[model samples]
Target chain A: MISIDKYAYNSRLRRRDPMQKLVFAMMTLSVCIWAEKIIISIAVIFIMGGMTVLKGGTPFPFFLRLLLVPMIFLLVGVFTIAVNICENQEMLLWAIPFAGKWIGFSDASLVKSLKLFLRALGAVSCLYFLSLNTPMVDLLAAFRRLGMPKVFVELMELVYRFIFSLMETADTIYNAQNCRLGYSSLCSSYRSLAIMASMLFIKSYKQSKALYTALEARGYEGEINVLEEAYESHWGWYIMAVAVNALLVLFVIALKSITGGLS
Target chain B: MNENILETKDLHYIYADGAVALKGISIGIKKGKCTAVLGANGAGKSTMFLNFNGIYRPSSGQVLFNGKPIDYSRKGLKELRRKIGMVFQDPDNQLFSASVFQDISFGVVNMKLPEKECRRRVDNAMEQIGITHLRDKPTHSLSFGQKKRVAIAGVLAMEPEVLVLDEPTAGLDPIGVSELMKMLRQIQTTLGITVVISTHDIDIVPLYCDYVFVMYHGMMVLEGTPKQVFTQKETIRDINLRLPRIGHLMEILKYKDDFDLDDSINTISEARIALKDWKARYLKR
Candidate 1:
């Protein structure tokens, strides 16, 4: 998660308007889910991955690794859908006899599971493209512009800002405990872990109070208002996004007409 | 003899848990002059600073800004904070935003200035702190010194009449300390903002401050120019504080070594000039 944040900050498209990236990612994600075709899903995955790596400057290996993170869950879910029980063995592509019924996967279920897996992957890739290229700060600014609830946005901003420091504090405590041999034994390890957790909680509480006082000193009148950063936004990016999504929709329509069904 | 811009009249603060932090503290922060509040840990320095911005209302007595008692009304505090910006010790606590540009602009934006003016101030603050290169960097990625600069820039953007910092030199490297103090002195001199800093770093007090106040056990033990305050060596050491290194070295030379050196010198340049004068007198002898 931290590495992804680092990449997002260093992304080549970081200077591009976050709203543009957000709209493109959401539009493509909707298209990928709506056009429930194996070919279209695969195409969406490639397009999103290509944009994130080639355009956003994330390494190809890292992108591939990130894509594999969901593969375990996807495979487990797809496995459940691939196996079925039926009364007629004739409907089964592969079957095993079980208590007078056949338990197996049919050709239809196999195709359905494969399509579902690709569709989910395609949807996830769209989100990855967005996150890999846009930092959380930029996203929050975009959220503010889009009329997101002020309370929700403020909470998110504060959480995002402190997460790194909280992690550092956790790391420091862990090291300090290790130095004191607090984790030398399993029994002590549990004790040390509990102590660290309580310490972190107390420290965070104090830190929150300090943050509030500091904010009040700066005239924070119940709002975490800040000037939004200016980006090199152009209508050309929005036009390109709409045109690409329209092309995908058109291709899906042409495929439906040609195959005459949910191809 | 500048008039006081901010003053506390016999101010007292007691925490909700029945702990007294400040006891009848009265001090005047001269306008357009740099002031230092020196104290050991838990000497009520931070408590006093919080009261300066009305973050902590005094239990007894009052805090005055521009010769008027600070109005505790919401609108009045909003107006007062605009003129008395504060930079906290822990940059992580003060910098609520991840982006340097946004964090610097937070105080300026809260002033409700025009958009263009806010942008200009933020840019100028970044430039003043030499953190323009860090403007795009996230707060978490910055070094501790860089984060300190960003925190200062955040407050400096408001263009406050009096900039109060609590422990500004703590946890900084030697070079970081000097550079930060230099920048602060420049801000105080060039912009004429009354700078007040609370720190136990004795070395910087003589170098950067025009006036000093020493606190002990929730009370003001001493207040004067650095030269006058450092002269009470026993009082300073009794309160768990010490003179600057040069001052200590000069004391050893004058008393223990029986050298004709001025033990009153606290800073390096002063010690050097004093030693040059002693050398000239010895040559005449």
Candidate 2:
């Protein structure tokens, strides 16, 4: 999580308007899911990956590693969908006989699983493109501009600010415990973790109260009203986003017309 | 009008759980002057500060701003908070937003100022704290010293008449402490904003603060210039505080080492000048 945040801040696209990125990522994600075609999914993945690495200056290896994060879950889910019992033994492409049944992946199941896997990956890549290029603060600001609930955005802002402090505190506590041999044994490790967790909860509670007091001192009368930072944005980025998504849609339409549907 | 920008009269604060934090404390913070509230842990300096901004209503006393009692009404409190910005010690607690620029603009925006004016104040405050480079950085990405500056910038943008900082130098390094104090002194002098900081850093008191108030067990035990306050050595030590290191050294030189140096010299430069004069006098022998 920290690495992603760090990369986002350091990315060349960090100063770009977050709304444009949000629109582009969401549009591509929906297109990837809606097209339901393996080729389109692959195209969407490449488009987002190129945008993140080439334009945003995120390292290609790092982007590839981030893409692989969801692969394990996708493979497990796709495996369940691919392997199934069939009444007709001849329907199974590669099957084993099991108590008067055939259990294996058929050609249709394999295609469906492959499409689902790519679609999931493609959607994930779209989000990664957005997150890799835009800091959470910028994203939250974009959400506020999009008319997200005021309280929701404020809560996110506070949580985002305190997350680092909480992490630092947790690190300090863990180090203190380690120095005292609190984690010498597995049993003691569990004990120490529980104690730390409870301590963290209490500490955060007190911190919240203190934060409230601090906010009040600044004249926070119920709402966390802050000035929205102005970004050096132009309509050109939105236009480009729309034009790219239009091309994707046209490509999907042309493919559907040419192939006469997903099959 | 009175010279004091803020004053607390017989202020007492009792927590809901029956713990007394401040007991009838009264002190006047002079307008446009830097003041230090020296205290040990649990000295109720923070509680008293909250009372100044009307965050915690005193149990049985009045907090006067500019010789007029603070208005506790919602609208009045808002106006008062706008003029008396309070920067908490922990930047994390004070900076509620991840964005440095936005966090700095928070207090100013609450004042319902025009958009352009708000932007100007935020930019000016960032420049004042020497954090224009950090304006685009997230609060979490900043170092502790940078975050401290950002926190101060956040309050400074409000253009408050009196800036109250609770333990401003608490978690800073030695250089950070001096740098921050110097920056604050610059702000106080240039902006003419009355500044009050609560700290146990004895050395900085004489070097930076024009006047000092010593708090012990929620009561005001001493109030004077740094020189006058540090002269009450016995009382200061009884409250678990101490003279500045230079003052201690000068005391030893004058008494233990039989040097004819001034014992009241608390700051480094003062001790240096005093030792130079003593050497000049002793050269005749």
Candidate 3:
């Protein structure tokens, strides 16, 4: 039932040399960071979102789900700041006056907190795009091409692979336990957890040895080469990407300048 | 006679926790023959298979590849391992690369082959396994059968002399098992690569293997052709194993006087034909 085409999209991104994507990401990120005005941040977010939707076939619902986490944090920050305003403030919105201003609110502080929340949201949105749209393999490959230390890239690859593998092993152990009726009570669940952990340790140890053997069998001599052929972006695609990003960067600068002038 | 490409000399292995996995096992794997190692759970079939590529160094014994003892030194082990590719029991363990193409190319890249040659081998391996269409697909999303095929392709890309598989057909549905057996048979015939597989599936051995090794308690208890091994009902019973269903049915037919049939029916289809012929003769009478 699995569609190969759906999975192929990730590799297609990988084909777009990691180095180019990294450069593109850095350029976009730097602009996002420097743009102080909310309008500019919102503009960059919308632009990036549109492009991701086009390239990744990602839906609005997917973006909504990703934003849900940061949205909660933003709400919490807003609520905390709104509830814990300092006393002796001019034009206080509300005051509990419990034990001398334990809880109060001020319009000025509220506006300032809202601005901070917006900035945080903007940063989070940019990160979500980068992490979700860009394949991790391509990112690591780009890092390697950028002259990052081999050991660092290797460590990253191993760590990423290990997380997925460990999860799979855990799932298998859980299934095996379920089949054996290993968990019927709270005590049994605790026992199952311990057993699962021990089994994972043993299995991981064995797999490490087996993996090394498999690697050696393939003529591995310390160097791990991925069979990724880097493709240069078409001039048209490069220009489009660069032009769009450059325009956003310039727009952010212009918006910031306007905000400064107005202030 | 073909030369012995791999041999184990009293190879012994114990787990870190002191469980003896293999105990003084000695066997020579002949080149270009499909050897099936059959054993029950905890019979050390896997431990013995792991020794082929020096995954586990024997406690006191030795493994020799091409008549040279496998040394634990990095260079020596790497050289020995490169010639004997293994597909683990779990396809998930073997197919860890992000995409099918990357998984297949992993061994080739490890070999440090030229990029063009590596691509050619990856293409060829995928084609051989009929998974060329899955090249760009993420391996995690594949079915168990598809993942197993990808695992085999990964090993095939390495072009090792011996392909050691641990329980290749385990956990597969009937159709998947047959399909995998068919693929393994094709690879053996077309590539002429030596294959050593460990499995509890006695049913598959008669159909695919040229020789069988039955292990029990960390030692090989029986070794022979499938015909020879399956005909020994007592030995199979001693090891807590059963004969193939066809063999069992053949024995039952011999016990019944009304069914006059040859005692040598070795496969289910042959048994079916024998039953049909008996029915026809009896109905005529």
Candidate 4:
């Protein structure tokens, strides 16, 4: 997760407007989910993957690792959809009998599960394209511009800002405890961890008060107002995004007609 | 005649938990000069700073900005904050944004400046601090010194007339400490901004500050130029603070070593000059 955040800040495409990236990602995701054709799903995956890797300059190995993060959940969900309960052996690819009932994989169920799995993966790839290329600051800025609730964005901004500080504090305290032999035994480790947690709470509470004072010292008037991020506002990126999603739509339509609207 | 830009008159502050943080403290900060507030930990340096910018109202006294008592009204506070930017000791607390650009621009943006002007100020401040390269870096990714610079840039972007930094050199390395003070001194002279800092780093106080205020137990024990303050070695030592290392060494050389040299030198350059004069004048004896 941290590496993904690092890459998002370092990506070559980071300089592009986040709203544009968000739009392309959301549009492609919606199309991938809406159009249930397997070919279009596969095409969406390739498009998002290629954009993230080739244009954003994110390494392929990193992107592949991120994709694998969702794979376990996806496979578990798809397993339920692919399994079937049957009385007869008809169309049973593999059957396991239990308590006078047969559970097996059927061809139709398998095809349906494959389509569902690909569709979900395709949609997830679109989001990956956005997260891998846009830093959280830019995304929050875009959300602010898009009229996200002021309180929500402010909370997210502060939370995101402090997460790193809190983590670093925890790491330091943990190391300090370890050095003092406070964690030599499992019981001692638990006791030390509990003490650290309480200490972290007090520190964070004090930090929040201090943060408020600092913000107030700077003329903060109940707002986390910051400068709107500058980005390369290019018409070509929007046009290209629309063109790609439109092509995917056309492909879905053509596939449906060829298959006689089987889906 | 109004040389003092910020002044505290019999200022007192008590934390809610029945602790007297400042006890009838009074001091003045000159306009367009670098002032150092030297104190040990928990000696109310931070509380005094809070009073400077109206972050905390004094319990029984007054904080004056430019010969006027600070106005605590919303509009008045906003106007005051526009003129006096306070940079906290911890950059993490002061910097509420991960992006250096956004964090630096936060202060200026609060004043409702136009987008272009905010960008210009951010760019200019980054250039002043020589952290233009860290513009796109995340706040967490920056080193301690870089983060400190970014924090300073955040306040500088607002173009405040008085910059109050709490322990600006606390977490910095030796090189970073000198470089940061140099940068701040340059900024102060070049921009004519009043720089006020609170620190326990006694060495740099003599080197960089024009005037020093020594705080002990929430009371202003002494106030003067660096030479005037550090020369009172016993008085300084009474408050859990001490003279700068060079100043102490000069004192011992004069008293213990029986060197017939002035013990008032607080910097290496002054020591060199004083020693050379002594040698030229007394070597024949």
Q: What share of the true interface contacts does candidate 3 keep?
A: 0.55
What is the CAPRI rating of model 2's predicted complex? high
What is model 2's interface RMSD? Answer: 1.0
For each prediction in turn, the share of the native Cα contacts (below 8 Å between chains A and B) that it retains comes to: 0.95, 0.88, 0.55, 0.88
Give a tens-digit lDDT track for model 4, residues A142-174: 899899999999999889989999999999999
lDDT of 3 at A210: 68
Q: Which tens-of-lDDT digit does each residue in B1-285 have in candidate 4?
A: 989999989999999998999999889899999999999999999999989888889999999999999999999999999999888998888889988998999899999999899999999999999999998888889998999999899999999999999999998999999999999999999999999999999999889999999999999999999989987888899989877888888889989999888888889899989989998889677
Binned by DockQ into CAPRI classes (incorrect, acceptable, medium, high), candidate 4 is high
DockQ of each: 0.86, 0.82, 0.45, 0.81
Which order, best to worst by lDDT?
1, 4, 2, 3
Tens-place lDDT per residue, model 2, B1-285, is 689999989999999999999999889999999999999999999999999999999999889999999989999999999999999988887888888898898888888899999999999999999999997788888888898899999999999999999999989999999999999999999999999999998999999999999999999999999999988989999999988999999988889999988888999899889988888898978
Off by over 4 Å in 4: B282-285
Off by over 4 Å in 3: A1-15, A78-111, A169-206, A220-223, A229-232, A235-238, A252-262, B1-3, B8-28, B57-76, B256-258, B276-285
Model 1, position A107, has a per-residue lDDT of 95
For candidate 1, list the clashing residue pairs, or say none.
none
Model 3, docking class: acceptable
Off by over 4 Å in 2: A87-89
Using DockQ, rank the candidates from best to worst.
Answer: 1, 2, 4, 3
* Residue B236 C-alpha lDDT in model 1: 97
Alpha-carbon deviation at B63 in model 1, angstroms: 2.0
